[model samples]
Target: MLRTTEQKRKYIQATRSQNYQASLKLEGITTTAQTTQQSKAEILQKYKKYSQPES
Candidate 1:
């Protein structure tokens, strides 16, 4: 079956994302909801220093 260029691009992008996710799972680096939240908080905390208003 012939796919349009857009269709082919979408399929390739989806496949690449799926493969990247699968690889992350294989490497035991998948982020759960809790871990995701924690990472977000940690990131915010880490970068908070630069957000201070000038005195």
Candidate 2:
């Protein structure tokens, strides 16, 4: 329903702003692990192993 250019820009900005509100989200993740000496997949897999329920 956004017919005007200004309205479209406002709608797009509003939608993108919602994505930036990470503190309100449930599962917020960070890329700080990527700066570490460990590889990306290795760190993720380690967390994945700990997150799972034991058999």
Candidate 3:
């Protein structure tokens, strides 16, 4: 049986998350559910600022 496109995408996302968590664990950093709407917005804003070029 073959997986659908959405299923493949989900599998890849899960794999990436697992890999990231494992790397953090190896570094003695535990994962936490500390992300809130404000934090997400702040992160996005920081990225937006970082992605802009000098004018």
Per-model TM-score, in order, reads: 0.54, 0.40, 0.55
Estimate, for each residue in 1-55, the C-alpha lDDT of model 3 and write its tens digit.
4379988888888789788888998999987845234777788998999999999
Best by lDDT: 3
Structural RMSD, model 1: 7.0
Q: What is the lDDT for 1 in model 1?
A: 52
Clashing pairs in 2: none
lDDT tens digits, residues 1-55, model 1?
A: 5379998898898789778778889999965533233677788887897798879
Between prediction 1 and prediction 3, the one with superior lDDT is: 3
Question: Mind giving the per-residue lDDT tens digits that candidate 2 earns over 1-55?
Answer: 9999999999998777566555435466543312246888999999999999998
C-alpha lDDT of residue 46 in model 3: 88
Ranking by lDDT: 3, 1, 2
Better candidate by lDDT, 2 or 3: 3
* C-alpha lDDT score of every prediction, in listed order: 0.76, 0.73, 0.81
- Worst lDDT 10-window in candidate 3: 31-40
Location of the lowest summed lDDT over 10 successive residues in candidate 1: 30-39
Which of the numbered candidates is closest to the native, going by highest TM-score? 3
**Off by more than 4 A, model 1:** 32-55
How many backbone overlaps does candidate 1 show? 0
Q: Name the better of 1 and 2 by lDDT.
A: 1
